[model samples]
Target chain A: MTGDQFPLWAAIAVSVLLVAGSLLMLAGCIGMVRFRSFYQRIHAPTLGTSFGTIFILAGSVVYFTVTQLRPAVHEVLIFVFVSVTTPVTLMLLARAALYRDRIERVQDVPASKDPLDNAEMQTSKKPS
Target chain B: MSRVLPYPLLTLSLLIMWLLLQQSASPGHILLGLAIALLASRAMAALQPEKPRVIRFLPIFRLAGRAVVDIMASNIAVSKLILNPNSDMTKSGFLTVPLELKHRFGLAILSCIVTATPGSAWLEYHPEESEVLIHVLDIENDQEWIDTLKYRYETLLLEIFG
Candidate 1:
């Protein structure tokens, strides 16, 4: 946010990055409404979470490093944290959604997956 | 070395995370961060998660680079699909992809890659069947998508984790 100390080229680059990141995020939100199915809607926010955040974080890093005269790659923690955690959340959510759809005997659910019964809803289904 | 640091890599990363958060490399911060990292690593060791044995290191970077390129490309594609009025929305659907890479860690990384990209969301992984169910935002062709998953990412993952 503190960009007054930034020179002309840095300002342009940061602004462009920040704007592009915001636009990607805006499109992601719009996608939540634009897409119809719950499954399809799941892919929307990743636009913001993945590269959108990257661009924005890059801008922040550039801004801070230039302004403070220090390496501001700390935002990499956010990137690493998100990359590590978002998949777990999205996978669980998608599995729960798919489970509910399968249980309700919803049409168009992938036939390859067996319908979950009350007893079989375990998270450790992966073969260790 | 192994006795003092049960998980050297995990402890090192935690220490680095603490330093990054503090944004300082001062001696006081380093000692404090080391203590915190040791404590955290001990706590993590209590959970007894199976440490992934990465057989090769180089392909890991290659896979990451390829995934980055794909992410950017898909980000644009999905954004265009979101914005265009005349875009065909019906092409989006679920696809069952048969996977050959079965290493648990490899599968975990694959899930991250698939879900981290904009145009796809990994729905369910069938470990028993060695297949995964993924939802594609724009499924122009099922075979093409399958090939992309298998060849583009899975092959490199096999090199790194399999």
Candidate 2:
């Protein structure tokens, strides 16, 4: 059977890794729905992108290493890309949200530290 | 030597990536990967970007190990926060930490490390003031975070990039 393609121990390890990774992702999704504010919600998705991606990639590495009998670590490229891009995109979205909030004068959001944005915000508020 | 191979590390990594992607170690594949890596590295040299010098190997490895452990720990911490309906988020808020690690590459690596952790996010950085704005999911003690960041990460990064 195709089930016997890999050893039982490898199968068990892969299964555990996959399940744990998916549960982390599911928790991240639940967090997205549960959190109240935009800034709070922003932290939720990182759960999936960080260790969640690493765990799943780890499972792939283990399975491929067992079957192919070679170190198959190219899956690490995905983790690298995710780790780099996730923060960049998250930072951009957060800055955009902050800018919008500052212009609208949301009470909790701190004023812009960026002088250029500070000037633009000043103009945006004064014109209103 | 430096002229032909502007970045030995970059070329070597690209070659390794090519071989891994192709999943082969044949002589022809190695030669082809070398050629591609050489061409790509030359293109990179055209940009004339200052390469980050990882001066110390030990701190680099240490930082990587620490980041992995912290990521796992924070995953559990964030998951607990998500699962507990009664968990209050009043303690969650933004933190502004002034940084002395002025090296651009050091700052970038620190940002990646901070943002990669699940319970924290890197929001913005003001280079003029040399400060970073981060959002922490659970910040019971602000000083603790500031200390952890400055001592744990920024110090290691400064060593590596220095």
Best lDDT among the predictions, by candidate number: 2
Q: Which stretches of candidate 1 lie over 4 Å from their true place?
A: A1-5, A112-128
Every model's Cα RMSD, please?
4.2, 2.4
Best by DockQ: 2
**Docking quality level of the chain pair in candidate 2:** medium
Tell me chain A's TM-score in each of the predictions: 0.82, 0.86
lDDT of 1 by residue, A1-128 (tens): 55465599988999999999999999999999988889888989999998788899999888887798678766898888877887789989999887777656577987545445444644324332
Give lDDT tens digits, candidate 2, residues B76-116: 99999999999996678989999989888888888888887
**What are the clashing pairs of model 2?**
none
Alpha carbon lDDT of each predicted model = 0.85, 0.86
